[model samples]
Target: MTAPVLEIALLQVRPGQTPAFEAAFAQAQSLIAGMPGYVRHDLQRCLEDDHRYALLVWWETLEAHTVGFRGSPQYQEWRALLHHFYDPFPTVEHFVDVTPGRLPPS
Candidate 1:
């Protein structure tokens, strides 16, 4: 079986837009949570930089995000609801766990 992939995005929201961005993200979360092959996700704010956020999403495969989600209509809605809050567009990347075994079960 293929290991899961993690999508990482470092988001720099416009100054003074954190609250709006966070509120929009709350609404947008459901769009991603319901996608096929989605494992889970988290959006964390930076302590040093309140305008910054780290978005981590785990998916069953890379295509589950690059194709399955990005190509779906929900992504358009996701973009519409949250895109404007960004300063410069965020760069998204995917990674697989490199350890001998993944994280221990909780």
Candidate 2:
């Protein structure tokens, strides 16, 4: 069995485009949810910055996101719907469970 991985991205919506971007993301999230090995995800808006967001996606493995999702055609649609809203574009990173005994932090 493979340990779960967390895919994190800091999303910075273009000025005045937060609402539009959020609407698009609402439609695009399903594409990620339906993929193989997908666990769950959360999209959170920064209280300090309304135009900034954090996307935290949990997958069964890194490849489940980097290979399965990004390599699929659905990703194209996902990109089309949400990519343009980004300002400098977000940097996505992957992380693994670190705590040895307790449940991972939410």
Candidate 3:
């Protein structure tokens, strides 16, 4: 298994708040994309469950996110854009992409 290297944040917006959620999320994405060691982030909306959204984030390491990104000025923007959309704090989990196929061909 690879070292635990990815931080996953799963978010669920309040019902009927998708538009507001997206507006904030877009602003955050713009800010976070510019940070060092911030590799990628993608957002998904649920068709079956309208209030559900998924935020998939990849970074060089967990420290790059929790320490570097959150510690930077850019994090304020990230917070402003995303914090209110959540009905509650997000469920955060960390795991490595350890599947033989989950990792890039090497």
Candidate 4:
């Protein structure tokens, strides 16, 4: 079996738009959840920065996200719903488990 990959994105929302952005994300998440190879995901808000958020997504493989999700028509809908909230846009990175079981499931 292929080990899962984690996708991390640091999202910075426009000033005073955190609530709206969160609401939009709540709706947008289902799109990702239904995708092939999707495992799970989380959205976390920074303690010191209300407008900053972190998105962590797990997939069965990197291609599950980079190609399967991003290349699909649903991705365009995902972008339309949530992309505008970012100021400079978020940079996404992928990571592998340094030690298996170090991170617990959510």
Candidates in order have lDDT scores of 0.94, 0.93, 0.78, 0.94
* Comparing 2 and 4 on TM-score, the stronger one: 2
Listed in order, each prediction's TM-score against the native is 0.93, 0.93, 0.84, 0.92
Stretches off by above 4 angstroms in model 4 are: 100-106
| Poorest stretch of ten by lDDT in candidate 1 | 97-106
Candidate 1 Cα outliers beyond 4 Å, as residue runs: 101-106
User: Which has the higher TM-score value, candidate number 3 or candidate number 4?
Assistant: 4
Candidate 2 residue pairs in clash (backbone atoms < 3 Å): none
**lDDT (Cα, tens digit) per residue for candidate 2, span 1-106:** 5568999999999999998998999999999999998999999999999999999999998889999999999999999999999988899999987777966545
Model 3 stretches astray by more than 4 angstroms: 1-4, 101-106
Candidate no. 4 TM-score? 0.92
lDDT of 4 by residue, 56-101 (tens): 9999999999999999988999999999999989999999887865
lDDT string, candidate 3, 1-106, tens digits: 2243667777889878889888878767878788787777778887888888778877877888889988999988788777877877898776767676465533
Residue 55's lDDT within candidate 2 is: 99
Which window of ten consecutive residues has the lowest lDDT sum in model 4? 97-106
- Which order, best to worst by TM-score? 1, 2, 4, 3
Model 3 clashing residue pairs (backbone): none
lDDT head-to-head 1 vs 2, winner: 1
